[model samples]
Target: MHLPSRRPLLTGTAVTALLLSLSACGGGAAADAKTGEYKLVQNGVITAATQSEQPPFAITDSAGRPTGFAVELMNEAAERLDLKVQYKTTTLQGILAGLSAGQYDIGVAGVGATAERKKSVAFTTPFYWGFTDVLTLKDGKQDALPDFDGKRVGAVSGSVQEDFVHREMGGANLVKFKDQTALITQLLSGGVEAAVLGGASADAYVAKEPVRIAVKLASLQGSAFPMRKNGDPRLLKDIDHQIDEMIDDGTYIRLYKKYFHDPIASDLIKERPKLAEQVMNHPDLAPSRR
Candidate 1:
């Protein structure tokens, strides 16, 4: 999951000032008086923020439009709601901060639904779940988590991988990059001995780069859409409902197959038993036998 950066606690006034500064480029939406639903930033538009380079989840296509699993899911959800989306690309930090400041209606760049994040923003039902991977040069000797201790490791700034490095590899020299692209680049360039990434993202990079996954960690908390807390409960409910509908109707699985060839993560199915039934009833969707 793309986790938020560790930041110093802000004073009440400082937080308000920061939100004001961060929101200068956009206007906040007001709630609909009659329905108590959150109004769109624009009359019929959902202002969304996503990462430009978190591939397989969020990426800019050749034509420069936001198009990836997460983005497409949100786009479909918006369409079902009869709304259009205007996307802005930014770092994961920007996505979270923007949501908090009311600068964006939704954030969809593979964000993890972590407890710490729930304090300031709301998350829809998680749509995806997977593991974390440690990536190293094809010839690098590091083959396990402990092997990387005291070595230089890279992770996207404000990402869960960053948190992992801090918590698990306490003695490692942690190098933080602005995004996955930079982290992978630094790994390949020998700027860092290894890099940590989301499982699917690591697979995407390993397919095209000269890196290999040396370690695959346990499943991470699921990825979900983040919205400003206390902004609009109705909107949150609507999105969660749409996600459930998609999962039930197989729209979610169809999109999942489009980007990922691996079997559905077992933990995901465990959390959503209905999805497990779907896989069981359809052999084609079943996980490969080990």
Candidate 2:
């Protein structure tokens, strides 16, 4: 499928202000869910910026509305708060920069909470967490992370996997693409030995394509929502609180299974107790109602 080029909406000083504005609060008066009032980018709508392409997480439906796990999850949460979500599509890199500029009140697109990303925006507690995986054609020569050493490996530019490639897979020939589809195409065409990406996305793709996960890399990252730093404290709190309710009521797991087409395995949950507990709603971790 054809996709628009990843380009900045604005450059120079304007770009810096949006990203840095998080350090200082900038918005209308505080929002009150009870009264149905919000300090939104536009009144009566939450301008959500997201990647135009990430599958099973963020995508434009046939009707032109954004519909996917992360997008719908946010949509449901917004419904509970009585606010409408107006999605604006952009590339992964553009979403964060635009969010920083206050162009979008929320940003979602399979974003993981990495230290580097936190500098640009604040993350909600992870709604989903899993290992990164190396994906290659089933008949490809690469079989594991070690096998790709000094060989070409594809990752979306600025994605967490790209950082992992530099930090853990040193000496690897890194090939960056604007989107996952392109990265996987390179891997299939033998342009790269393998592509490093979220295990879930890799698994989903391989289910329909002639590819397989070569290695489930040890590095684990948690995907979450990104809001401008110091942007809207009340909005942030409400979102976190809403997420807690969703987990408590099993809504999050339902969404996870619907999109990923499988439950987060029991053994995997055991390995990441904290993340599991958050999504599972252990009695001790349940949040109080407002």
Candidate 3:
């Protein structure tokens, strides 16, 4: 669909910030992820910025190599666009700092595209969704969380779940953790009745525990490469078109299935992040469906 043009929201200073960022961080790194060249970068090149400690979004491989669902998908997208994907990994908190300083093109971590963030950068259509669920004590099955009006809850910092808490579950006790592990650990240790985190990872952690799905709250819509404001529609169009094609051709599903494990495969995912009223959902174009 159609996203806001941003001519109205962006002030003159913000536009200057965008241009300055692009000119400084625009070029440097290129390599192939599938090939050895993917590991090495030429001296004269630009690199992208990404999250360092975040899981699912990105995490180092068992061999200590950089590899995560988002990272790999980014490499693939770069390959499809015939461009080099270079990245500097940092923390989620500092991602926006790096973006504003022109140290990187876009932040590749799991960032929720809230209206507040759009003032500084632009995001592409969402490719995946972060499944954050409600959790409770092992025996604390009350069906739904709204049932526990006065119970305490927990979530990670800079997470979509936190946003949900501040907006919807304001009456419930809410706490924030630094990461998913800590959030679940706090829940298990009785720090809170339940924790909010990505469903895939949360499911993996809560296995065999008495904790069950309280309710799958809103998802942090997964997004592809983010761009500097008004940076380059040419680049955006190319990436968007490739993603549209990937969704249609089954490549997107293959990569997602290869990295992510879930029961709600294929059809459960429909809603996506929005820039105003425009639904930035992935284009459904599987080859078989075609």
TM-score for all predictions? 0.84, 0.78, 0.66
Order the numbered candidates by TM-score, best leading.
1, 2, 3
In order, what is each prediction's RMSD in angstroms?
12.4, 12.7, 12.0
lDDT of 1 by residue, 126-223 (tens): 77887788889999877667788879999988888889899878988999999988888889888999998888898899899998888877645888
Winning model by lDDT: 1
Worst 10 residues of 2 by lDDT: 1-10
Ranking by lDDT: 1, 2, 3
Candidate 3 lDDT tens digits, 143-218? 5657656777898776667887877677788887766667777788888887766666566555756576767643
Tell me model 3's lDDT, rounded to 2 decimals. 0.57
Clashes in each model (backbone N, CA, C under 3 Å)? 0, 4, 12
Off by over 4 Å in 3: 1-46, 52-55, 207-211, 218-224, 261-290
Candidate 1: where is the Cα deviation over 4 Å?
1-37, 284-290
lDDT-best of 2 and 3: 2
lDDT of 2 by residue, 140-200 (tens): 6655456777898899998898887988688789999998878878887889988888867
